[model samples]
Target: MSCPICGAEQQTKYRPFCSKRCSDLDLAKWLNGSYAIPAEAAAEEEEWNEADRSSTEPRH
Candidate 1:
């Protein structure tokens, strides 16, 4: 398999990535939201319901 970030042949040490740099690059992309999927408007309603449910639950 090749590195998704640089197309280098994947090394056993890096598994899906070819090197530590590529792995870090991939992580940076996620941290910077470069890999984020666009949220649908309906997701907000679901998030609000989840928050309400959590707030109503008693903490142990």
Candidate 2:
């Protein structure tokens, strides 16, 4: 298999990445939001509104 980050041959320790550097780079990309799963804004907005309402409500 090849590295997803650099297209180099994948190493045993890093099956999807060639080395620690590539692995770290991929992690950084994820942490910085370079990659994302698409979401529908309408659904997300509804969820957010529900969460906000619940948070503001008095608890028993």
Candidate 3:
């Protein structure tokens, strides 16, 4: 099959990518939020907001 990253023919070890370089590139994209979707669920947003608030607020 063709590699999704570079459109090259995929190697046997990297079925969806051409080689280790393409695979690492895809992983870097994922880790840096390049592939993220906008807006999570309301509950998740609420949770994130709570965490942010806690981090910024002073201890009692």
Question: Which candidate tops lDDT?
Answer: 2
Task: Return whichever of 1 and 2 wins on TM-score.
Answer: 2
Question: How does each model score on TM-score?
Answer: 0.63, 0.67, 0.61
Of candidate 3, the 10-residue stretch with the lowest lDDT total is: 36-45
Off by over 4 Å in 1: 42-60
Error of 3 at 23 (Å): 0.3
Q: Estimate, for each residue in 1-60, the C-alpha lDDT of model 2 and write its tens digit.
A: 899989999999987899999999999999999999887998989999999999999999
Q: Which stretches of model 2 miss by more than 4 angstroms?
A: 43-60
Question: Which of 2 and 3 is ahead in lDDT?
Answer: 2
Tens digit of lDDT per residue, candidate 3, span 1-60?
A: 899999999999987899999999999999998997767598898999999999999998
After TM-score superposition, the amount by which residue 59's alpha carbon in candidate 1 deviates from its true location, in angstroms, is 37
Judge candidate 3 against the unseen true structure and give its global Cα lDDT, from 0 to 1.
Answer: 0.92
RMSD of 2: 5.5
- Comparison by lDDT, 1 against 3, better one: 1
